[model samples]
Target: MSEPDVSKVLRLFKEEVKVINVGLEYFYKELRKQGVNAAHVIWQPKPELEKDLEDILKKIL
Candidate 1:
């Protein structure tokens, strides 16, 4: 295997990066106010029993 292309990754980051704010509405609003492309998702804590499964699903989905 070989090292990845850092220049290509940097170019893509500069051109097409986006921010996803999963919990805080204020942070998302602030980012948008700064002219950034951002999105917000309302997130809530699951019940204690469901927390473990929800964490796994969060990673997979």
Candidate 2:
């Protein structure tokens, strides 16, 4: 729509925006530089869980 939704816009302007950046330090830094709340989580797959096994686990779980 051309015009913004009033309530949504008001909440955005009034509330603090939060962001969780996983596996990307750049995005977290940029978000902080822009003054938004940000948390960076470093993540990696388990060493024993190979790609094929991981895929099967995803299907089963």
Compared with the true structure, what per-residue lDDT tens digits does model 1 show for residues 1-61? 8977699878877795688899989999999999889889999996575778888989999
How much is the lDDT of residue 51 in candidate 2? Answer: 88
lDDT of 2 by residue, 1-61 (tens): 5976599878878888888999879988999999988899998875787789999999999
Best by lDDT: 2
Residue-level error in angstroms, candidate 1, position 11: 3.8
Q: How far off is residue 37 in model 2, in Å? A: 0.7
Q: What root-mean-square deviation over C-alphas does model 1 reach?
A: 6.7
Error of 1 at 25 (Å): 1.1
Q: Residue 44 lDDT in model 2?
A: 86
For residue 1, model 1's alpha carbon misses the true position, in angstroms, by 11
Candidate 1 lDDT at 51 equals 79
